[model samples]
Target: MPLQVAPTFRDALAAARRPLVGMWVCSGSPLVAEICAGSGLDWLLIDAEHSPNGPESLLAQLQAVHGYPVTPMVRPPVGDPVVIKQYLDLGAQNLLIPMVDTAERAAAMVRAVAYPPHGVRGVGSALARASRWNRVPDYLRTARTTLSLYLQIESAEAVENVEAIVSTPGVDGVFVGPADLAASMGVLGEQDHPEVVAAVEHCLRAAKAAGVKAGLNAFAPALARRYLTAGADFVLVGADVQLLARGSERLAAEFIEEVR
Candidate 1:
């Protein structure tokens, strides 16, 4: 039989034309991934960059979330081709590459995710879950069609080159990382600082003009809405760790205060 090309989350995201809300998964727990996947969010990011997720862990998380409706986007530590290849082979169709600073780097990420004659992704689908152990027919030939590549603009330099980065062919979207952008602007933890906000807005506008999707990772709901209002195609409102911490804290405070 020919490959059954099911419509992926990337397809849904591109067609929605509305901000797709998501959350970060840094817990490296398949259970957490499964829970988040079933939460009805548009997408979920399996973070290998800041978390202790290795290939095995990523595979488990991917499996954990496969049955849900949520799209799982994986982020490697950097935009290294090797790391990207590993994640892709492990069945990550959507990627959120980090620390992209220039058009050249962004272009490299595009190439890294594709196969030969288009890019340099190594072919090993037969041995990988990405092809369902060779069950998803013609995976190598059609994988690029379903792949979504969103580069992170986390620095002042990246903000300056936003136009070029978003205009690079095959880039699905641009993700503005306010936390790192704030640090790069010398404001450290002040993501809402005027300068940082300005930079983020600038990138969003640039992406809009370039006809590419824009995204943001903002913890605050109000700030996330601001980005969506400013034309962000997607936004991450929270993380698994933050949710756990805050919920546990609230629970403890509620009971501990009763004893006092």
Candidate 2:
């Protein structure tokens, strides 16, 4: 018994009575991740998609944040089962899969994260930190409960099928990717476009209808607050690199541009 460690992310989210605010860890630096983890955020998403993070980098980030009170999540490049398996082995229990556009795909993701007889996650617990090297008693039997699967509704097709996708048996939550949804709706680089906002609201409503947690990614404060007001249970507010870029720009503006 590893002291009951901590509540699963799914359990924690379900227990939360208010919306959770999170950020992206795109820098792939363990020290940076630890800083963010301790900065009082409710959660953190370690991105492998659109970021340079690989398994090793992700492993380090997870280890760095392991002692924090925040829930650490992982977003694989895609929802491939093998990649999911690798992340799970590396001890990622909270997963946000990108580009899931259909109920079928969503169900496949559910299966991919589970073990045999119920789903299809290959068993390697004894060789992995996921079970704390089999230290977390009955790891295989209880793995499903400790896991949270959030499928990203990022396309027009996905938005249309949001109801079915959220209704899938093992889907714990649905995440709306505003930028990708905008691009899918032929409005690339305009995540705040009216049509995209409407679509995101629709997905949020669908998640509420299905009784599953709804999440969104919004770097803009207004947009994040808007989605939160519309029933988003969790939101990714910013990225590490984005923060650094903006902060450095501000410094340069003050120190260099001001003197010019």
Candidate 3:
């Protein structure tokens, strides 16, 4: 099977007038990644920040998504240079860095994700497992251009600095992490909090002004729609575990009611 490059996701988002649906797969299971990839999702995000997945697990998940229609993305714990470089080297086409609060942080993330001159990402095996062990010789040439870097705007500070953050070079897009943003504003679990909503709107406006894409993490279709209508370029839906739990609970409840 021909290995799909990172451009697929970038192009998909670029071409979409409306928001694209992305499912979060944090289980670190290759099987689950494959399933999600074939499930008509526009993209799959492997959560390394909140999930228990280490480097190896992340790599496996990325590999599993290969050849499928969904583009694979990794959400690293933070925007640390080493962590960013590690996942990029492992072949993650897109990276979602969490808790980006300032333009400086966004710029640092860009530097971490890019190579020399542009940034300080240590290069090793260009033909390593990330490139299918020499299968793609031109990997380095296209790597910088093909890579997608989404900075998570999830705090009051981030919202305030939204304009500067989006304007930073190499920052492909901005994703709103509503839960965290709400919490940071002292309103935990209130996704609909006035402050959170305002912040999201600010991010959208900033992204649009900067001519860059914007994204959001939403669990429900309704929530996703809200973001889309607000001009989000990409929308991430529920996680694999959450989907499974919800489905299982509903099925069990239905069966119990039928028996009664």
Candidate 4:
């Protein structure tokens, strides 16, 4: 069978008529990932940053969602080049790098994913699923086009450098993280704080002005809408674990009261 490169998150955004709505698959379970993949959302973020996912589990989840229509993006725990290379070799075409607080860091991430001369991604296509075990023609040369890289602006420093960060070459997009931005602003757990909102908006504007895609992780309907209205090109509006948590709670609330 001929191997085909999938559409990247960048391509999806450029082609999308509206903001691409997505959710987080944080449970580290392939079953949960499969369920979320079929939910008709435009994308799904398979989180390894805050979830219990290891390389094996991440690979399983990625494989599980391969047949679905949703675009699966991965969030590695850190922006280390070694880690990025690992995830890339594991077949994560879309990546959301957390805690990128400066343009230098953003540039480093670019080099981390690119092949040497352009950058320094290690050569191991034959052993990598990303190349379909050497079946993908010109895999090394065309890998960049098939990939999308979004850096997370989760701290005060990142917001302060928002313009430069968005303007960095090879950074496909920036995904503003209000939750951590709130923490960095000393308003821990208050994602909707006015100050955090302002910071988030600052990033949105910078990305849009630079012609780079901007995204947000907003679970609340109102907040997600607000970010979208603020010019977010894509938004993660829900999560698999949260739905189960809230749904099961609601069911228990009704049944426990009647059963006891």
Candidate 5:
């Protein structure tokens, strides 16, 4: 199948009759991006907030993923409109905004992703990679449909306002940040803490009730399966950096053992 011009993450979810598996690409390397694209994964998240990916690096990564089957989604540090616009203009079909704590904040995120009337995303030159560098003049007409917006409910405040946040217009989905959420819940370093688990389940229930997709970041296959069975639509398995670190460590350990 030809690579889609502007495929939304939600579109991918809708297409996923079964559970979907995604991997986080925090390393911003072209080779890594290419590998993930060619892998059988449904989508790849280009993490900018926690990664060392400046715009240049992100451009290269996006280029590397081009022509592959997996869609590219970006998670900006915060849901700043300028940052969101820049990434969207750079060809990110989907956006995952972090630390959404209220319905108003969720609305702001939606506005940043949308055009006028629906939201306040400023429109200008579609002469960017997102529009195939001026290849598509009807970009604005189909932009909304092409873009997906996900709000991260990763804080105590967010869990409290989960219902309102998920009900906001243009909010496509919710992603749980277990680490941050655990900290926010005053149970730091305990992802499986009862309070944290309750918060996550609450968020899931809210998403289901509102008829929106729910997502979770699962670092292990077992955890990924658990989330899927618990009603998560999308599950992020691992990150490029973490995978590399683990592989290198294991290889070095094996070599040392052999030498000994």
Candidate 6:
């Protein structure tokens, strides 16, 4: 019998018919990854960019969450072709590539995730888990069709070129990074600043207008809801580190105040 590949978070995002909520996992721990995977999230971002997760750590985390229903989306430190190749080979079907500034870059990323005659992703031998160690037959041939590529629109320049970037063929979606976008617009941490909000909203609208999926990393519930209402296909509501820090701080603060 042949392998049966299930629908991915990317497939849902590409459909763009509803809102898919997700979270960021920066802890790089399989324990933490498994815990979050049980939280009923639609997807999870295994952040190798800001997190300490190298390829090995990412592989472990992906394995930890393999039994869950949630899809694991990995973000490389940078959107380099070689880096993406390794992640794809490790069984990551959904990707959030960072710092994409042009349609050319987005197109390149699309090719990076595809096999020959479609893109330049290097073919690996039977050593990759992506093929289930030879379990997933013809993985090289079918990978291009199942792989979902979401480019990160994190800069003023990227936001300016949002429409063009969304128009790139094989680019499944675009994720707006408000933090970097704010910094780019001269508002270091003011993601809620009217200017930054406008830019993010513009990108969201642009993607939707182009009939492509739009998503964002909005940590605040109200903010995330606002974007979803404005037609975002998916939104990453929070990060593991933020939840741990805030929850721990709240727990400790209550005790400290009671002792005082």
TM-score of every candidate relative to the true structure: 0.96, 0.97, 0.93, 0.98, 0.95, 0.96
- Ordered by TM-score, highest first, the candidates read 4, 2, 6, 1, 5, 3
Report every candidate's CA lDDT: 0.89, 0.91, 0.84, 0.93, 0.85, 0.89
Instruction: Show where candidate 5 strays beyond 4 Å.
Output: 1-4
lDDT digits (tens) for residues 126-236 of candidate 3 = 445666664665766666876888889999988888999999988889889999999999999999877788888888988999999998988767777887888888888
Give residue 116's lDDT in candidate 2 (0 to 100): 96
TM-score of 6: 0.96
| Clash pairs for candidate 4 | none
Error of 2 at 214 (Å): 0.3
lDDT of 2 by residue, 132-155 (tens): 898988889998887889999999
Number of colliding residue pairs in each model? 0, 0, 0, 0, 0, 0
All predictions: root-mean-square deviation over Cα? 1.4, 1.1, 2.1, 0.9, 2.2, 1.4
Q: Which candidate, 1 or 3, would have the higher lDDT against the true structure?
A: 1
Candidate number that wins on lDDT, 1 or 5: 1
Writing each residue's lDDT as its tens digit, candidate 6 over 45-64 gives: 99999999998999999999
lDDT tens digits, residue span 1-260, model 4: 65987888888888999999999999999999999999899999999989999999999999999978889999999998889899999999999999999999999999998998998899988999999998899898998988999999999999999999999999999999998899999999999899999889989999999999999999888999998888999999889999999999999999999999
Better of 2 and 5 by TM-score: 2
Q: Which ten-residue region of model 4 has the weakest summed lDDT?
A: 1-10
- What is the clash count of model 6? 0
lDDT of 1 by residue, 29-118 (tens): 999999999999999989988998999999999899987888888899988899888888888888899999999998898999999998
The predicted structure with the larger lDDT, 4 or 5, is: 4
Winning model by lDDT: 4
lDDT for model 4, please.
0.93
lDDT per residue, candidate 5, 1-260, as tens digits?
A: 22237567788889879877889999878898899889899889999889888778888998898889888888998789998888888878888998999999999998898888877777863467777755665777777887899999899999999999999988999999999998987888888787887788888889999999999887867666767788998888888888899999999999999999
lDDT of 6: 0.89
